[model samples]
Target: MTEAVEYDVVVLGAGPAGENIVDRTRAAGLSTAVVESELVGGECSYWACIPSKALLRPALARADARRVPGLAEAVAGPLDAEAVFAHRDYWTGHWKDDGQLDWLESIGAHLHRGHGRLHGVRTVAVTGPEGEHELLTARHAVVIATGSRAVIPDLPGIHGARPWTSREATSARHVPPRLLIVGGSVVAAEMATAWQALGSQVTVLVRGPRLLPRMEPFAGELVAEALREAGAVVRTEVTVEAVVRDGSTGPVTVVLEGGEPVEGDELLMATGRSPRTEDIGLDTVGLTPGGWLDVDDSLRVVGHDWLYAVGDVNHRALLTHQGKYQARIAGAAVAARAAGGSAGAGGVDTGRWGAHAATADTAALPQVVFTDPEATAVGLTLAQAERAGLRVRAVDHDLGKVSGAGLYADGYRGRARMVVDEDRQVLVGATFVGPGAAELLHAATVAVAGEVPVPRLWHAVPAFPTMSEIWLRLLETYRG
Candidate 1:
């Protein structure tokens, strides 16, 4: 017999996306249930973002000490990778998903700690950790918030090879002596930086012309240079043909297409990630081409109407914050639907706000790469704007020329660029690269999101002797 439970909404995957929806739905007086197979906080909290950043902090501090005058001599020893892993473990609350579980319970959201699959259009069946079987039928909606998995390329000798993904790279106990990273995406660049700083001889093979090709060309150039400066041998514009393990003594040898073969002790594949839409019973509902659940403007899965897709499953931007945003909207939509209120109540379109909805993300999504000299970017680049047929003007400034940047380190060299709509004089995009630029991105994000006018932004003073003073210098350079 199927043990059935009812809810206003049943969210599959209690990651950040599902949790956000559960919290918001309960707040709106709607019954919500979340199902999970692993950590409640999801990938970013456990492996991707939090743990990776924790591993990078020591490298950042060491870099700061090296560059900051009077601080270089005070620093005594090298970073201990073991100690860093211990600290990462501590910050992750020691691998017990208890903290997140407690939060879910406190929020009045029922959690089924098991694998969940779609049984019907609005039904989810769960096999709990304790050998309990449960069926959940959502009176309002069933949301698929299952995230994505790292992509491993099909290369020779990849089989029987102990390759690392973002998960392994972020959680490994010990760093390998030599690491070969395939792909030039943010993950590849970041892992290269982190492992190289932690005493790994790193080499990155990229098929693109430059690293981070999706970013501004200047930013990509800067990142490439930074990787070389950090002792990473970066091979660009080369396709990888084969990766084979060298007998026993030499490192893993990776042969490039029309290029020389390079060797490393470990091969970390950072090709990319694919949406995890398989085996969750998406076919029970219906899936679009490319395995994405068909969703409408209101985040409703087409045909079924009550079904929705959120997070990476929707095949939208695979970002943690964006997924949470989708969840909040989905929760609100469910509550609105249950209240007999039109999604158009109070001029608020619940559809515009909920499951699989990433309206704001399209306009204000931000990306940051925690490289040695961190890189942060938001919105369209100059080329992107031009490609979109918008008239844009760009102004750039060097970090060393900014007073705030000067105080942070003796030989600060970084670039800050803003793309502006020539007519409205509002920023469309911004990129900042160099030490301390990661923290400087939010101000730019706020400016872009608010569509703050350039003249009005001039009055927004940056604190003196801070990295953000580059904003003022950038504006000045633009005016000059």
Candidate 2:
């Protein structure tokens, strides 16, 4: 028999975005239910973000220890892959999905274990482990937090060949002797670093001119240099025309566009991802042309009043953090509506602040690439700012001068660039590339988000001898 359930709000996919939404909704005094098929914590915790970084951290630690003369002798060589996996398991709590479930229960959110599908405008059907369960209606909203899946590129031999995606790369128990990476994105760079540190010779083939092309040129240059220094063969403006297994050598031989053959023990495709909207019954309600659930500024699906989309499913920013931000807003908006408030009342403004119905994503999205030398950036590129018709001034600073960089290594090489709206005196964008730059991004994020003026930011002060002090240097360079 089909079971009937009711929820003020039903969130599908308990990822960072979905979790944040439920958290905020419960705080607003709304009854919510979350449905998840896999691990409750979503991709960030188990697969994509967290685990990948875990694979890289031991490498980073080894590098750090080798830099300090006193610590160098005591520090062991590269991290053992087994030990790294053990540590990663501990961080992920051994992939226990129950921890996230408990958190949802503690927060007064109901959990449905199954795949969720939209049945109608205000209805969701859950096929749980037990039987057919129907969530009759959302008194307020139904959120689609279904994340994304990796996009597999087309190559002549790629179909038959077994290639690793982010999932396999992050969770692999052992490293291959040689690796060939397909894409030039941040994921490719990160995996290249982790595998290389674990004793794999890596060759990265990028279809684009530079790694992390989304960041500033200075930032990309620093990472490219770091990768080359760490013994990676970085190739740009190249395409993998074909791939085949060499039985004699037991390696995958990849042929580039012009018939140049590159061989590796393993192949990793870090091309990109596509929204997971194919099977979730978007057609049961309605879907847009690009396989997206079209949503307004508030993340409310257009035409379907109670259906909302969040996270990667919405086809917005792919970062887990950004997905969480969108989820929080969508959850709040739905809860408000359920509580007899207008769907748009006091809800986050999607326009000025990426509020629902807001198309201002490019203005303030933060991205970080955790390579040997990390790369972090937020907001528009100089070209983007100019295209938007804003008068922009950009300043680039060598991070070697910063106390933070000095502490990182005896001979430090890093770069920092900031784009300011000359008239507003507010940062339109910023990029930092070097060791420990990932931690340095929040100050810039806050500056851009808060619209802190250059002079005022100078007054805020970064602590002495910290990588954050580079902010002062950047500001000084801008003045000069």
Candidate 3:
């Protein structure tokens, strides 16, 4: 027998995005039901962000310590891999979802542990692990926040070779002696830094010319340099032809173009990500399965009044933080429509940069790569601003020249770039590459998002003798 459930809102996938939407909708007095096929907190909590950061933190800390004069002598030793693994396990709660489940219960949202699929308009069919069935009907809105999964390239013998994705790399119990990684994205760079420092000889093969290809070119150069200095092999402009693994417990050999082979205990394919919409019954709703969802600023799916797509599934921004931001806007819009008002009514503000609009997805998206020489950027790159047809000026500064940067490390090597819209006299983009660069991103984000004028930025002074003084240097360079 199939059970019938009713809710004001039905959300698929209890990831960070889904959980936030549930929180927002429930607070608006809307009854919300969340369906999850795996662990409650999803990828960021258990596998991607948390575990990966935990594995990288010790390595980063050690590198930072080595840069300090007195600390350098005292901390010249390898990290305790066992202890690091234990710490990572602790952070991920040993892959348990009890805490997340408790939070959902406290929020008064029903949790359906099953695979949920769209049956019809505003309708979802959930199948529990034991074959129990429940039909969930939403009176207001149905949101798809299922997020994305890693993409492994199709190569001969790849399946039998047992390649690791982002999930396996982050959650591995033991580090391999030789790690082979494919792709030049964040996952590849970060994992290479992590395993190499954690006692693995890492070899990275990038099809592109550089790593972190989406960001400014200097960012990739700096990261690649650091990886090589740390004894990792960074190979770019290479093509992987095939993979070969003889048995269950054997070294995997990656065959490259021109008859070259690279062998390692494990191979990780951090190529890219795809939306997890293939099996969610999108065909029933007149939409294509296995395709990215398209949504407007208010996150409402095109041509569907009762459907919404937030997070990575919407193809707006792939970062977890960006997904959460979109979730907040979508939740507000969903609640507004449920109350018999337009998304813009009742101070919802659906216009650009409004409470109901995910404007940051385009205007001021911020990203931080947690590499040894952390790279962080906001808004647009100089190239991006130029491509957008904006008249811009790029100001550059050497972070090592800053007094505070010199004090932070014996020899701080970094650079900062700010792209200014000449016509508007406001900052349109900023990028920082150096140790502790991630900490200096928010001010740049604010300047770009708020569109603060250059002259006014001079009045909004940075404290003397800090990495933040890079802003002052950049402004000085721009003035001259």
Candidate 4:
């Protein structure tokens, strides 16, 4: 007989989103149970964000040091690959989830270590590793925070070729000697930067015209230039037709269209991501299987009053931070509804930018690509603003010209752009591409999210002799 359990809230997937949901709901005195098939901390903890950033930090630091006058000679030699790998391992807790488990236990949420699927409305069936079956029924709501997986394209001989996804790229112990990357997204660019700095012959194949196609065009241009200067090949407008591998462990050859075949020890296909909803039994709950869940601002699944979807599974915003934001809103909404109060109807603010709404996902979605020249942006691009039918003006300034930028690095090269809503004279979007530019993003995020007027922003002073001074230069450029 299957063991049956009950809880006020059942969360599927113990990722950052699911964990945050548990944090909020459990705090509100809701009996919560979280289910996970893998480690408690999920992808961002074990593979994607933490490990990737851990691996990239040393490489970025070395690159930054090389730009400083006296420090350039000190870091002229190659990085210690083994030391870097050890650092990455340390950050990921050596791929052990004990620390995460302790945190969950501290929060007083029941954890079901198994693959959980929706059995029906407010119900879940968990299958443990030993084939142990357990049924979980929720008294309030069932939340799906199962994240996403890498999508490897169906190319000839691809499966047998054994390409690395974002998981393998970030977690691999040793760097490939000749690494061929297949896409130009954040994962590809970052891995290329990482592996090349670790003494690999990295070649990036971009089907699109440039890298980081999502950000401003100049961002990609600067990163590509830096990659080429660092002895890595950045090829654009290239397509991979097929892949060939000799054995289970052998060098792979990529057959390209209208170009010479490129050979490499390993290939990383950072093509895209698909929601991890295929096996979650959505079909049992009157929803299509393997589909992105659609949710309202409150993160409650549309047409399903008892179902909620957070994180990448909902397709709102794929960033880990954004997923956490949605989780907070969803957790509150679930708690409110359980108290016989509608999210917006019962003294809860569900209006735009309210506590019960995830307004920042669209208004001020922030992202930072940790490359040699970090590309950070909040809100929309100029084209995006124009597409949204906003009367906008894009103000540009050369980051290299700023006093703080020159002081930060010799021959500093980067750009900054602020998109202003003309009628309102407030920043709707901003992009900063340069060294330590990630630190500049939050100010931009606040300006966009708060809709602070340009005249009012002039009064907000940026500290001198810091990369943040770019803000003042940007405002001055706008004025002129």
Candidate 5:
């Protein structure tokens, strides 16, 4: 017979989303148990965000120094790749989760080590490495936070070749001498920046005409320019037809459609991501497995009050920070119901910006791509606003012409856009692209989320001689 454990909440997949949900549920005096098959800290901690940023920091620092006339000479030497790898290992805790596990225990949440599958509504089955079987039943809600896996295209010979995903690219101990990356989104642009800086001849192939297709077109143009300047090659309008590897120690040769075959020591597929919901037993709950789960604004699964899907699994926003945001909403929503109140009165006041509502997911979502010329945007793009039939005007400003930008970098190149809901006289969205532009995103996030009126925003003065002053320039552009 399988041992059975009961908790007020049982969370599957202890990623940032899962951790945040548990954090809120525990704070609400609910007993929560989290199960995981991989490291407790999940992909962002071990592979995606932490490790990738750790590797990119040195390169960005060097690039910044090279911009300064006096410092450029000192930074001309190549980075010590060995030392960089050691630093990344430190950031990722050497792929260990002792610290994270300790923190989870400190939070008074039970940790289960194994694969978790949904047995039924509010029921989960677990199997450990040693062949132990256990059943977990949740009194309140069962959350699917299993996150996503990188999608490797069905190219000929890809399975046998075993190309590197974002995991291997970020966690790699040694930078391959020749690296080719496929895809055109954040992963492609970021990996291209990282490996090329760390002494790899990085080449990127984008089936689209540019990088960062989701953001403003100029953002991709600028990053492609910077990547080339940094000694990386960017190829657009290309597709990988096949990847072949002969032996365990052999290199992978990638053949392209209508293009010459390119050989590389390693091939990194930043193609995309797929929800890891296939084996989670969604089919048992009358939902499709191996597909992105659907959820309501409150994050509860449609037609299943006791089920919730957060993070990349929901296909809402495939970003770590966004996943955490959704987790907070889900946790509060769960806690409210567990506290003997309806989801509406319990704490999920679903009004705009209500305590339990995830309003930003629709109107004020913010993203910052950590590239040399960072692309930051909050709320809608101009095209999106127009598509929504909002009577809006887009104001553009040149950061290169701003006093603060010139003082910060000898030759700074950046662009800013603010989309105004002309009928409402409020900002609906904003985008900033440049060096250290991410630092300016929060102010825009506030403006967009707050829906601050254009007239009132004029009084919110920006301190002069700082990157933030660009906010003033944008407002002025709109006024003019």
Candidate 6:
């Protein structure tokens, strides 16, 4: 039987972004319905962020201990991969969404488990799992938070080999003896870090000159060095000519350009991601299906006033934290627009970091790659700041030179860079690489997002005998 439901907001996916939007609108007294095709928590919870981080933590802990002489002797041993797998399974809830679904319900939002598509503006038609159909109408807005999927390059015999995508790589119960990972993004680097630690004879083939090409060149170099130090083989400037497998569950033979064929029990394609907009019926609404949707600073679809694309589908910034940040802005905007952009009637302020504007998406995008050396950066690189025509100077400091850093480890190895716009005298970017560097990223995020001037940053002193003191060093260097 067909059913119909209506709400003030109809969200298409219940990932971090969708869930947050629902929370915001519900807080504003709007009725919300979130339709999800898979587990309510989506990729990060089950596959990408949660499970991968859970798997990486033990390895990172072991690595950190090894760098400290006293701790090194205490923890010189292989990580129990099975125990780590158990921990990862627990974090993923064994691929269940009961907890996430409960949270949505508690927030007074409706939930529908099905494939949702746009039937028209502010209207959605969903096909449920058992072939049931439901029509959802939104009086205010329709949101596309469908996120993205890993892209596998087309090559001969690739499909026959049944290669693993991120889902398989992050959630696999057992480690393959020999693993070949393709691509050079965060997924490839982090997974290689985890699986190799779990005792896989791992080889990473990157089609580019370096891994993490999007970040500062040094971040990739440091991570690659750490990976090699951890006993994982890192190969760059390579291409897979073809692939062949005798059986679906058998080993894959990957032929490289002008090299010997490489065999592995599994191949993980971490190439990149394409938005999951293809089957969501964008054609019904005169939008191109299977392509990234464009949106304004308020997250509203460019031409469609009542349609908003938040998170990965919009192609603003693919990181989960960035998506959640956009969701907050978009959700507040949706509510305020519903109320004539006025206050006193559940409206919002649209100022920079006020209530509705998403200014930080462009001015400041903070990311932390949880690799061994922990590459964390916010805002633009030195090249990007210069290319933007901003009068910027990059100040760098050797983290090992810091007294606090040396005390943190026996032989501390890390680097920090802060890009300051000379005219404004404010930091426009920051990058930190080393063990325990992730802990210092939030300060940089705050500096860039708030556009704190370098002079004022000096007054905002970092606590001594802490990794955060690097901020003092950076500020001092700029002053010098």
- Of the two candidates 1 and 4, the one with more favorable lDDT, higher being better, is 4
The estimated TM-scores of all candidates read 0.94, 0.94, 0.98, 0.98, 0.97, 0.97
Query: What would you estimate as the lDDT of candidate 5?
Result: 0.90
Model 5 misplacement above 4 A? 343-347
What digit string (tens of lDDT, one per residue) describes model 3 on residues 1-480? 376788999999999999999999999999999999999999999989999999999999999999998889888998899999999999999999999999999989999999999999999999999989999999999999999999988899999998999999999988899999999999999999999999999999999999999898999999999999999999999999999996999999999999799999999999999999999989999999999999999998998989999999989899999999999999998888888876435666778888889999999999999998999999999999999999999999999899988988888999999999999999989999999999999999999899999999998778888899998899899999
Which model is ahead, 2 or 4, in terms of lDDT?
Answer: 4
Backbone clash pairs for candidate 1 read 329-353, 329-354, 330-354, 330-355
For model 1, residues 231-309, the per-residue Cα lDDT tens digits are 8899888888887886644568788887578888888999988877777777676553237665655556777768877
Q: Which residue pairs in candidate 6 have backbone atoms (N, alpha carbon, C) closer than 3 angstroms, thus clashing?
A: none
Residue 197 lDDT in candidate 3: 96
Angstrom error at residue 141, model 3: 0.4
Question: Regarding TM-score, does 1 or 5 come out ahead?
Answer: 5
* Candidate 3 weakest ten by summed lDDT: 341-350
At residue 469, candidate 4 shows an lDDT of: 86
> How well is each residue in 367-400 modelled by candidate 4, as lDDT tens digits?
9999999999999999999999999999999988
Error of 4 at 253 (Å): 0.8
Off by over 4 Å in 3: 1-3, 343-348
lDDT of 6 by residue, 1-480 (tens): 366687999999999999989999999899999999899988999999999999999999998888887779988888999899999999999999989978987888999889999998899999999988999999999999999999988998888888999999999988899999998999999999999999998899999999999888999999999899888999999998888886868888889999669899999989999999999989988999999999988888889989999899988899999899999999989988887765445556656666677888888899999998899999999999999999999999998788888888878888999999999888889999998999888989999988887878878877778888898888888888
